[model samples]
Target: MFLNTWSLWEKEPDYNSYLGLAENLDEKGYAVSFGDNPFDDDKVGEKVYMHILNRADKYVHIITPYLILDDGLLMALKYFAERGIDTKLILPGIPDKKAVYALAETYFRTLLNSGVEIYLYTPGFVHAKVFVSDDKKAVVGTINLDYRSLYHHFESGTYLYGAKCITDIEADYQATLSKCEKVTYESIKKEKAFVKLRGRFMRLIAPLL
Candidate 1:
């Protein structure tokens, strides 16, 4: 990760500084993998997410601030949910970016119809970017479930397999879930017409968000 950051630095590049820091950290026993974009490839983060989702057997719970998915991810998620895997997503109720939130809302109906559960944090905005599945795998990082983060930004995340921290991550997800309001088909039907229209318009330029 440090090497990736150092390589990304264009002005006053200092490779030795990052190398020095990297040399001090000792390897551990936990099965952890790092995924970053641009440095490795634009799809590094997306591949990590897809790999986890495809391997999940029991459940997959995700918390993301934004939700602008491409065809591949959209299909993968829908397939899992349709197969009766416990698929759930937590999104922000109080949006930090209204336009982006509207765009995200455009996906609700499709996902809901596919049996993917949706929750909105009612107390405030949910900025967390986390994916925990099957109590054995989890990812904690800066990558949002949006096109900008997946394909355009320099994002990174740690993929944890059989790590003890997976329990704590799932625990936090449950605690946060208690504060969220589950979204239902009825709720989507009740959404304001103007909001729906705005979301539809936002989809046209989602890649730039």
Candidate 2:
């Protein structure tokens, strides 16, 4: 089932779709959560994502155009990496927004050091938001890895467990990986001061973005 989150800033905040979807998943014994208000700690997108990430056993593959990781999400990914899980992120090689890309780069070194493999998709821009885990669970929706997405935006994604498309999702992930350029600490460290400052500023105010 497809779920959608429409924020009040963009339209009206309608989380009925997500709430209903979560209910369905819950009945099937799949851990799920959804919230319309970002101010409420428990009823927010990040909480839902954290539950999913924490449940991942073997691998977690994420494909997103943006890569602005919040502290909690970053910690979850770091934990998975430290546990020897295959945690991978596929981002855009040529970004649609340079400022966002720069801000995302600021975390590359830290994430790399934590053992999270990062890939930059070549050929064209990667605009999909997908999460696949351990061949049994997946999430496909509009959740970006930025503070705006996790906090301000009323985003929605389908929480799938043993879905038929799981295999196809993994296949797509591998195919996309083939078109990516692996990111390294050395490559992201040579940025100019002004660029770094701008990125840092963007990262600082990501929630307001």
Tell me the tens digit of each residue's lDDT in model 2 across 1-209: 44343221233223345556545543332323234457666445565466657777899999988887767888889888989989999999999998988898888888888899999997868989888888977777778877777777777766666666787899999999999999987777677888889899998877676
Tens digit per residue, CA lDDT, model 1, 156-192? 7777656677889999999999999999989888988
- The numbered model that scores best in lDDT is 1
Q: What residue runs in model 1 are displaced by over 4 Å at the alpha carbon?
A: 1-35, 39-42
lDDT of 1: 0.82
Give the CA lDDT, 0 to 100, for residue 24 in model 1: 53
Q: Clash number for model 1?
A: 0
